[model samples]
Target chain A: MDITINRGDFVGLLGPSGSGKTTLIKTILGATDVYGGEVRVEGQSIAERRPRVGYVPQLETIDWNFPVTVEQVVTMGRVRRGWWYPWQRREDRLVAHEMMSRLGIADFAARHVRELSGGQKQRALLARALVSSPRLLLLDEPTSGVDIKTRDEIMHLLDELNHQDVTVIMTTHEINAVAAHLPWVVCLNGGIVDSGPPADVFTPDTLRRTYNADILVTEYMGMKLVAESPHFFGRNERGSADSSERGEHVHAASV
Target chain B: MFTPLQYEFFVRALIVATLVGGLCGLIGVYVVLRRMSYIGHGLSHAIFGGAVASYVLSVNFFLGASVWGFVSALLINLATRKRSISADAAIGIVTTSSFALGVALISRFRSFTRSFDAALFGNILGITQADVIAIAAVALLAAAALFVGYKYLLFTTFEPEVARFYGVPAGWTDAGFSLLLAAVIVVSLQVLGVTMIAAAIVIPPVVARLLTDEFARMLLLSVVIGALCGLGGLYMSFYLDISSGASVVLFSAAVFLIALSYTTLRSRLGSARWRRRSAASGKLEPFH
Candidate 1:
């Protein structure tokens, strides 16, 4: 709940379901009312410069069968900066085409968006987000339902964008994936329970505190991973966890 | 067609049909795509109150209907803005109450010459030159709005949340769309009638959707289908001595059925061909 994301930072938000991850994002978008504080960007209120933030929503937010071409969908991102007319200008179309080609979706520019696969759809959304050249990009579960290969490709694309000085803030449930790749991670459950490098925060104590369940955490190739505690299978009572059992759980939780 | 054009009434009817058909069809693309087809029914009924009020006040029917239609649309939007009332519920409450108010006013105004039957069912032959000009002008305005606001409309229709995030002026676009929808419904009420106007607003675009996946092509096809249905239906009604509205709706239905059958057959045949090719190539069929 209390954090500062510096410019050009790539932060991955990790939380369990109903842990206010989405609510936090919505508050950042100024879509939800914040009673006690203000959300500011570059010392200005978020409302004053909201257009500088690009958002790639979850796939379910779009209508796949909508009667629009991929090029048209991407062209929509230019609304804030493009010509006042509804039709995109020649140069605008060229810009959109270039962005699509960069995203590797130029081949399907004329095709209906419904014809796209899951990764292609995400890329198309990403293309739309980048068409406006925002300073910060926010995504809601970009890797949900995608294959591992596509997820890695999307993460690499985000990292590449970050290298270009475009900040990225994404909410993801993939603990190990974010742990392995992202430099900053924040675990949230109603509030920020832990925040630091993945190696420091993704331990048994933080996982249990954030998830409210016994979990096993391990590391491979210097990247941490988390799984549900095996003792959780039979031990439904929290009172039954003895001190020795808790110690064993932590040992198993962190490798 | 040649014989019908000789008479002034038939000519007026044909001109009106062409204009109304094209207008409804063009607007119907948005209606069907956004799944807001109920606006046609709701606004047509809401405009009836305005027509009856026109009769009582001796005002121009178009002026009264346009005002009432626009106000009713805004009211529906207002009710929906708070999220306290569902869109359909708002439409139902506002439109049905306006319609009931019209009936009540009509019952009180015994001196008014315009009959309720004419308002509810429409009279194609009753169109005058002034009516034709008004309809033509409003249709032109609607067309122009769509032409200039295509991207905003498409964005809002497909993804309003994202559109708003990028400062797409979602509020203005929605208000403009609601006003346009109201105008189309009110104008078509004279030809398609209050009850059947929604069909004209829905059928053509749906048929076009069956034929193409592209939006621009679908818009063109919907207009073509609408204009053809109007001309063919009006002519058939003249020859067969039937209700022109009913004839037009039936013609649209027949066209829809044909498009449906063609689309179904094409997809089936396409899949069968794919399956045969896969078998010939010794490839396993992927489980859907």
Candidate 2:
């Protein structure tokens, strides 16, 4: 909890549901109260610094029926800079167009938001959040419900952003996909259970403690992966007795 | 067949309707886009109580209604934020109670007169020169505020949390927006009456959405459509001897229906064209 994130660190918050991972990020972004501890970005408390913090919320939080185009959505980032006119500045428009093109959504710039696929929508929102040239980026479950390919694409995009020295702090349940990319990790279940490199914090003990179940860990390609035993919760009594009817045992293996 | 003296009222009604209708059209674009139509409706009805109270106290009805409407708006906003109540439920509570109180107070005064009917149903025929000036000023102020706060308002409407992270105080914007909506509702009530104001505030923007995707175009188109509806309804009322308020709302609804049908037809044709192009490109295949 007392650790410091440097100016360009790519950090991943790894935890199960009900953890304080989101609370920690919200506090860092000054969206929540930070009474006992201080959150500083570049030698200034977040409350005083007012750095541009780009936030990507969970996709389920938005009302998809909202009437907006992809380009218009991205231009919303400039709203705080006193550009309220419908016709935006040439520079802002250029930035927005470039961001959309970089995100591979240039063709969708004129399309209504509701017509977008899930991956397209996520990329559009990502472009929207990044168009203002924010120094710090926070993403909450950006890969949730997305296909594996899309998830990797989004992570790759974030990795590229991180390479450009933009600070990134993201939360995700997909530990292995992030372990290879993220340099620092914070594992939390109601509090900071562990914080260190992903390999050190994503052990079987940490996973079990975080998820409240017996977990098996395997190391492959210098990354820690977790698998939960289905019998940890016991079997049902009133169900079909056949092995096939026992419901395929759930096991998650990640690298 | 129209005499000059009688035609003056018609001309005045057309001008006043165009001014007020255009203002509502511009503001209603935001109202519908933000899903704040219920707030608009609530403010409109709550202002009724204020107008009634002012009437009973022999005060300026507009002043009473604007103050009361703003207070009611603030209370509704606070209740929605501070408590667990839903916004629709809160608005329903505030508007119904305030309007009922207004009706009760109005009942205690002298016998209900034709003026009460005129106030409830709207009387474009009796609008004074001062009324015209006041409506024009309110309309201009609303247009200017909308022009200045357009982007911030859109940002807040679509993604409030993101707007807040970028240093836009979304809550303050909401309060300011509610105050502006109150002003719109007050002016609309004076012109169209409370029972008919929601139609004027809702239909034009809904129609505009079918016509365009650009926000500026939507605003401009909605204003034109609303003014046209207002003027056309006024003329129809003058000639056909119908209720002016009802005629205006009906004309707006008619326009909305026509626009909806047109958009649907256009989209279908666009999709057909896309299908033909894709087929020619050998991208279309039959599903088994």
Candidate lDDT scores, in order, read 0.84, 0.79
lDDT of 2 by residue, A14-67 (tens): 777878778878887788867787777767888776556888888888877677
Where model 2 places Cα greater than 4 Å from the true spot, the runs are: A1-3, A33-38, A43-51, A82-86, A228-255, B1-6, B109-114, B268-288
* Model 1 quality (TM-score): 0.90
B184-279: candidate 2 lDDT, tens digit per residue: 777766568778888888999999888887667888999998888888777777778876777788889988889989999998998788778767
How many angstroms is the interface RMSD of candidate 1? 2.4
Point to the candidate with the largest TM-score.
1
Model 2 score (lDDT): 0.79
lDDT of 1 by residue, B1-288 (tens): 597788988988987887788788899999888777887889899999888887788888888888889899999888977778888899899999999988898789788777556577667887777778888888889878988888788888888767888777788998898888887877787787888788888999999989988888888999889888888878977898876677788888998999999999998998888778777878756633
Interface RMSD of each: 2.4, 3.8
